[model samples]
Target: MTDQRQDAIPDAIPGAVPHTRGVRFAVYSAHAKAIDLCLFDGENETRLPLNRTATDLFALHVAGLKPGARYGFRAQGVYDPDRGLWFDPSKLLVDPYARELDRPFRHDARLSTFGVDTASLVPKAIVTEDRPVAPAAPRLPKGGLIYEVAVRPFTLLHPKVPAALRGTVAALAHPAVIAHLKRIGVDAVELLPITAWIDERHLPPLGLSNGWGYNPVAMMALDPRLVPGGMAELAATVATLHENGIGVILDLVFNHSGESDRHGATLSMRGLDNLTYYRHVPGAPGLLVNDTGTGNTLACDHPVVRRLILDTLRHFVRQAGIDGFRFDLGTILGRSPQGFSRESETLRAILSDPLLADRVMIAEPWDIGPGGYQLGQFPPPFLEWNDRARDDIRLYWRGDGWKTGRLAHALAGSSEIFSAHGLGETRSVNFLAAHDGFTLMDLVSYSHKHNEANGEDNRDGHNDNHSWNNGVEGETRDPAIRDSRRRDVQALLGTLFATRGTLMLTAGDEGGRSQQGNNNAYAQDNALTWLDWTTLDDDLVTHTARLARLRRRFDVFSESAFFTGQDGDVLWLNEQGKPMTTADWEQPDRQQLTMLLKTRDREEDRATRLAVVFNRSHDALAVHLPGGPWQDLFTKDHVFSPVLPPRTVIWLRELADPSARDKEAGES
Candidate 1:
């Protein structure tokens, strides 16, 4: 091992950045007494001491180091768990800014703080020089459709996607995958966490791995298992999506790492400088604050952690050409020593960033911490996941009483929440289901979560699903029940598309994908989570496609402003064909209503007027039509008075002029 330092000084930042001659490896450890750069050559090892800067940043320049070189770090400091000073030189550490990993993580006790000589058990970081490039695509448009898909599950069973590119990021660029996205009228594809991650320790014992890549150890590094070609492959995928006019948004988990709580492994951040990297309990310095429910919460309030996250954002945006990001457990980003603040330095930095402020930014908006639910509290330019919409829509369609007002507020872009933020309905990303809960199919098929496969004895997932089994739970052979389930699914989806706000569809929901009632299938890497393309429901897929087409063609769904009611933009009516009164709205037995929407800023286009009738009762509803020649949106047939069947919906459009009818007929 050579103990030497090159002439050029390294940058006082984290990660390995390639320079003109060689690579400069920098790491921040404010509490560390010594830091060593370990270079691996096969089974042999060479340790070189790093030069400590005045800012407590350990750095070293090596002339021969280039891209793909495997390396790790060994931080030496006082080991005091109660005081939150955990550092051990014997345990190998990963670079928080690593762009790539040599291989997937294999769970071992030696990788923790209690083990020694853990050199071979840890994943090594590979050096890479990222070149600056312009963004391949523009930011997503307002009220665009965002499709959430897991890379592996989405393409693993595809017949057209090449087998070589099946479970990786490159598969997203395949002609078959791109064709499916375009056919669904998807504006943006939010790829779930592709960052290098570690399978939870308990999974291997049960013969499972985290199919969803939420437990990330390295933020900048793309997991080799997911992206074999690294950033090059990711860049190409982004470029292709841009060429096809579809933007790419990444689902990032910066709230926590794969490292668990006090009993967790000593991965990258924990071993580097645990005291400064993670937020310790206010009084009990040894324990971490469980804000994210992931065992450890990142100390984003710290300057070093802030810089690391910001650099990662820029790296992905400028080098990989990603259009935007959807932060997982995003509440942690705005959290501070006191609590979550809209004016936190971390949140301000991201919103005010020169390179990132204009890009599409989304937040999950809630965590498991105290006062974690901040759905409408996020600042401007951030679209939040609207769980309120999810629950209210589910409750209304599930035949729950006294939910009309809740559904109405949600359908209007959740104005009650976003209006106070000086934003409109477009600020809420509305969806029936997301990656965390029951899928759209399960939302109607199972009333209880079947998570026994997760090794938690079916006690791990949420119990209050607000779901209706229609008639039977799990699989049912009765064709009548099957038809009812199908109708219910259609109604939920129809309501979602007909509402005015941004829309998100989880992968395989169009074809009625289910996890056999498992709501939290995070650890199931096999058939349970993989999207089965073989037995797709053709009718359901067609219905979803039609809804997408409607959402895209109508201007009301994309309106940035809320309905003023006086401009004739919106109208609410009861089953008696009269404006709904306070008494009518409060009636628990009322199960049918009509919503009329006028196209925004397009009064000249008479065909843009739309009316939707929703009936959840057991009997058919007779809806009186407005004075116009109405045409069924899905059927393209003229109708005077329509009787909607029980538990069904009807969407109608006005064909006022002959030219409008011609245009409508042509579109149908």
Candidate 2:
């Protein structure tokens, strides 16, 4: 504990003295005639009575308050529940917008945010002042590929990552990890929830924790367990990633928390002001609303909760240079009192906020409530995780046809689903695999999900995985069958890069990472999920790099917005460059889909094109070129394969030098 002047809003950034020195501090406490900014100075309370004009703004401008000073507010007001005004002068309340906190509020009886002795069955407040300043981590977004990762097991046993840095945010900035990401061409790293959270009681006893990070307790603070030197080390990591042109994004969980159902204890929100933060049943005074498959859902419709969400977001952006945020179960953010509204205030605030306006705000897009599947309905400037694209691509490649039309729309950025909302191709965050379901290898090797490792008796995880086993269930002794499976996995990776949208590949998908058959590896935190860096499979590594390199070379394949018109930027054609017929799209066993992605070639000042032929059937198919001299980028040859074998994806790029390949062929 140290003594500090208590006059202004403290700064959270290092080196720079608080610009808010001598600035006023205020919070809306309408009932409190007198409010005190209880500054925790040197183990003593340096209390300052706030000078107020109106009841709405409880404010004060006194001296000696600097950065790192732990403080809370005490207000005097009527203790009531039905009318929604509960203020206890003896209780200490944290500022809803505080940039930093000493320690997270312990879920003890003493620190209830709600009033303990209400006239009725009202809530109570947890009166505890913060201590020590917790530094804030820098935020990230921009010019990066965000790889969402679970924090705890990311580097728990990596030989390169220091034992001290393991399992923490600072660990991500370790030299070895950073080098790996750079080597793989990853631009951004998105961490799953780092906010303080409580484990689900049911999971805690079984050695399973909330690995997905769907539960959150502290919104503005970093999880101490994942921070070595605490927020300061986390903050340093941000600066480091930014120096390397990489960005960071958090998997925010504002939908629900560990506190669930009507029987949960009164913690932060339930103890402070239950009605203000959580959605409740209409007539039941104590029955809380649940929608996130969790016990309760934070009501984004409420004024306080809305303000809390906005303040927390703005605080992170200001204190840290974070480039973006990825919202888990984000559909709940669009819900209103009437129902889930696309034009809800929560959504409106995110768009209008100057600090977050240009940030990479991505939504999980679906929940467990009614009309919860708000896939393509998110407003503009938002990226949605396109589960439809994931499933369709998997199904098509497995030879489940009569689906070519829908696959085309997805490959072209799902204009059918998002164009009406004024969004383009980049709005869809396309991926063939994510952490929630099966890995790319598992999707091709196992038709059924093997989630017994999750300890839920295989009852958990999605049943309709849109997968194929390639003639065998587990391992196969047949060489031909094994080769086919490996090729299909490569085809899926190629399609992910060739698709017109923001591509999100799971960490190990590029190298054919597998979990044996476990679709849900959330709890497996072992060799099953950790990337195997030891395997030196040169061909597989080269193939994955080739896919990423192709995406980097051709803008049309990775363009933010898909081009319209037959000759614009992309084209869907049959074998002979003609319109695809219903029979062609519906042919179940016919397994070739040809798509041409065109881009503006700067050197020649003309549009360059790349034709990708995806052959998925067991038999070979002859694909005709779209009436042009195409160069095979790999071999620098003009010889196009008229007949390509099954489970293969061939890419041919139009070259600027007409004689580039001819000269090479002559030399050969």
Candidate 3:
């Protein structure tokens, strides 16, 4: 062993730092009276008391320690839950900056604060060698087209993915997966959380695992089950995606951990210093501020937690080559003692940080806490998930009255809601379905949520899905019903592609994958939640691909600016081909409408115009055209007297210039 005589560096950063000697283990605990570093080897263990600094940071340089050494921290302090000072030395604590964990966490009574001995039950932090990572490529501001997916379910049923790689992060880099993503025109893969997590206490008894991976236990450590080969596997996946011009954006859950409410386990953060890591209810000591709906909300306002979050992000960016991050329950990051603020310390630090400044930042923008519905409240450079647009789109297609006006605003990027906040159309991440809600297929197939398999008596998932079952509920054998469902699915996808905002597509939506109407499949990690690759609807995939191609081809679809009546860029017309007035918008019962989108800065003297018609009424309507020779882009049918089928969306482009065809093909 090398000499351990070097001078101590005061106020050094936390976690294990590599040096010529071996490694320097350090941790921060503001209220810990004593801290011990325990190194494990087989059943044997060696404990060393770390030298405490004036700044309350504990440090120890062990000369013989090497990479892959299993280690954990034992913080000794007051175990007074009533006072919110949970520091149980018997329970081993994971390093907040641990790059890798040895095993998946198994929750037991011994892993709680009440247990006297629980070292063997907890996972140990494994020291890893730092590897150079490739620089991340620039991600599109609006993410172009974000595809949200869970890593495991997305590949488990894939016939092309190798058996060993299935349900692992490596599957994301498989050629078949990459090809499928490209086929769907996905610019970024917003992967569901891959961080180490533990199932909620209630899930194990029901024999179900959390499928969507939102319950993160360690923000920095990749789940051993998901990435069996460790960070290198994730890095390889990111590199593969980047090579194909696709960015990887992780959906991170920093708002809460797998450690549930006060009665939850004594995990890493809680064991180390619960008083500092979690936000407590203002006068009630043991009561945690449960803004995340996951029992305890992380105190992002605290300096220590703030640093941990930023460091975790930088680690992913620099070590795994992550292009961006989509914050789950993003409102928590901007919440303060008073309420949610755009200038919150954590939010500001993330925006101003050099390492993350250029990366794409998407926000879920809401939580179950007070003042948590901050949809248009996040500051600039942050794209927010537009739930308003989602709800309005569902309502409009469901044939709800007074929805046409709301649908119009949503398709136009909900400018009325976001514009005043200085957010452009691109800042709205619009989607008809997401991981938390119904799949696209379920959106039109089922009228109610079927979450009985989740073991909560079907009371777990969202009750108000705003979905329509067409003329029949659930799956049907009737050809007419199937055709209607198919048509509605196509219409919804086409509308999403045409809308002016950052479009997000759930993984299996393009292939018509259904979850049997289980909106909240968070705890059903079975075939019910997995994609049925063999039964993927090819026709639906083709239609979705066509829409994606159109979105890429037309500049009008992804324009940043909001439509102004004076710009001549867009014209709102009623089914009669006349310019619409306020009365047209106020007609709650009217469902037939048309949007004349004039191509931006075309080479022709008169710009090429495309009229998108939406006929949501039950009967077919003869849509009057705006006095121009038009061709149906889908059927190539000439629009002499355009008669649209009920519940149909048709796109008609002007054939004034013959060269327009060549331009369109070249653009696609």
Model 1, range 244-348, lDDT digits (tens) per residue? 889899999889999878777887888889888899888898999888887899999999889888988999998878888999999989898889998889989
Where does the lowest 10-residue lDDT sum fall in candidate 2?
118-127
RMSD of 2: 6.8
Candidate 3 achieves a global lDDT of 0.84
**Sequence-dependent TM-score of model 3:** 0.95
Q: Please give the CA lDDT of all the candidate structures.
A: 0.84, 0.67, 0.84
User: Candidate 2 on 224-316: residue-level lDDT in tens?
Assistant: 566535456656787788778677777788898655655443333443355556777777645667778778889887766787788777656
* 564-608 per-residue lDDT for model 3 (tens digits): 866457888997899888888888888798888877423333557
Specify the poorest-scoring 10-residue window by lDDT in model 3. Answer: 1-10
**Candidate 2 TM-score over all chains jointly:** 0.81
Superposition error at 591 for model 2 (Å) = 1.1
**Model 1 whole-model lDDT (C-alpha atoms):** 0.84
Best-to-worst TM-score order: 1, 3, 2
Residue 444, candidate 3: Cα error in Å is 1.6
